[model samples]
Target: MPPSDAPAPTIRPAAPADLPVLGRLGALLVRVHHDFDPLRFIPATPETERLYAGFLGTQLQEPNVVMLVAERDGEVLGYTYAGVEGNDYMALRGPAGVLYDIVVDPAHRAQGTGRMLLEATLAELAARGAPRVVLSTAERNENAQRLFARAGFRRTMIEMTREVEGDAG
Candidate 1:
């Protein structure tokens, strides 16, 4: 059986010092999930990774965003990002937050890293008066779906996407 009990992960908001580790974790998640879309994955280069990393770094500076990292021994094992999109769940009357992204190192799967990151995020949101939390992931990513479900999240919407060529009217 997989090791389900791991040393408690140290959770904290992302600081400038965490930029590199956050980039590494984000890139790893992208590479791992890219297998689901070869056309999108094939064109990704190291530069692309770095560029996106830089963007994430900047998001840390935005007041509307909260990017968190979980680490131990100088290695980041997980991270989660939350934001207030203004378009919150209408029925909720108090506060609202959205989980934009959450990921854990594959080596740490089933070790509660995802739960650690999520619980921490939810606490932060709750502290801020959030009554409704929301997020979206592809229906095909069953692992993520399961994680969300176990965290007490339920699907309220389905979003479909289509690609269009440039210069479409």
Candidate 2:
């Protein structure tokens, strides 16, 4: 199910009071799409809430980290968490920002909510002197891939993965 309706999100930097909602939205992320089951990625417990809360808190305190929320009518509909990373391996000449997390209420999808969150995150990072932005999503997640591409994200490389020292596969 999607959100009741599209939120006229007032994009801005998140505040302390918004922490609780930020955590909620983070949980809702895996639920937004059927393929994103948190249990499959992490242990199933309330610990996820605590982890998300801590992450949100870090975003609030880190100067190079930007946590943006899309709220309207006193409710947060979506958010994006971005962080700048300076590394010699990256394509950017200087520090580059990576969009770590982005989620819009499933009900609010296709209503510009996701776009708004990205746009705001991009702007925030740009203002902070980031040369470029990057992000990664699951290979099966076509919806998000399209959104990122539409927003000017290009395919730079493919990430190959392998499981080691696990139960015989």
Candidate 3:
């Protein structure tokens, strides 16, 4: 078992070998989101691991994407993903960065892993020339919101959804 006072994880760019653990963490992320709001997040399935592996592989090759992993004693503690993009027709702002996902293993929670990952990701996005960064967390995910706020993120928009009582179409 890892010691309670394990040293801080080393943050670095993810490699192909890290995909398996990342995929498992991705599945956990899916479960957390699905539990928090099933209507918004799809539940994880057996195929999710494979799909996430392929997706991460593609993201790794994208010039504007950043993927990082936090490892301690050769074990992955967490991972984060982000990307920079120019504002399209929908977005009024100029170039911006989007924090696509951040997931820390349950056992590593409260150990500063998530904060490290977030800071690293933000730095990478800034290095990529993004003027600002943005992300969305589930309404019930107060922990994540707090983390982002501590990292200097603020509420820029509110996403509200209402399910139609009956089919209008």
Candidate 4:
């Protein structure tokens, strides 16, 4: 957490002006996940920042989506992106709110910024009448796993991946 003298970060709906920092944070998320497992996650490329920002920019117009940012004195410290999704036959899941991304700048981690963003995201989802919310975390992200658990999420699935071409026998 920040020093008692420091102002607490405020959570608010993300705006077009926040795109630059949002893109940077989004790319950081991609890099961190790729670092956890190169084979399981997509690598971050030179265009990741711009591409991510542009993609999220489209979501800004989606009525069922929520994109939020945590800021302190004009500097964005983190963001969360989520959307309410319909039932999916492929995953055998019912309608739910899916958390797509939540990232905090490295310098601001472990300081309750992530928690604040998460809480705000949950509130937004609840306000939208989400029956339930689901999210996936990199298997190696123990910190995030702990956060989710503390927020009352329980395990429901484990995804497995295989490399078909390289495993011919």
Q: Which is the leading candidate under lDDT?
A: 4
Q: Write the per-residue lDDT of candidate 3 for residues 85-156, one digit (tens) a residue.
A: 898557567789989899999988888899999999999999999999988899999999999999989998
lDDT of 4 by residue, 69-113 (tens): 999999999999999889988878998989999999998898888
Residue pairs clashing, model 4:
none
Against the reference, the lDDT scores of all candidates come to 0.76, 0.78, 0.90, 0.92
Off by over 4 Å in 2: 1-7, 30-40, 88-94, 165-169
Off by over 4 Å in 1: 1-6, 38-43, 88-95, 163-169
Q: Is 1 or 3 the stronger prediction by lDDT?
A: 3
> For model 4, what is the alpha-carbon lDDT of residue 145?
95
What is the alpha-carbon lDDT of model 4 when measured against the actual structure?
0.92
lDDT per residue as tens, model 1, 1-169:
2344545779989887776766777777676557666544444568655765787888988876878888876777778989755643564433568887898877767777788899999888877667778887765679999988999998887765566778767
User: Cα-based RMSD of the predictions, in order?
Assistant: 3.8, 3.7, 1.8, 2.0
* Per-residue lDDT over 1-169 for candidate 2, one digit per residue giving the tens place of the 0 to 100 score: 3365644679988888887877777766644433454333443346655667667887798878998888877877788898988974555445688898998766567878899899989988998888998787867788999999999999986766555665775
What clash pairs does model 1 have? Answer: 95-130
Clashing pairs in 3: none
By summed lDDT, the worst window of 10 consecutive residues in model 2 runs over 36-45
- Candidates 3 and 4 compared by TM-score, better number: 4
Off by over 4 Å in 4: 166-169
Regions of model 3 farther than 4 Å from truth: 1-5, 167-169
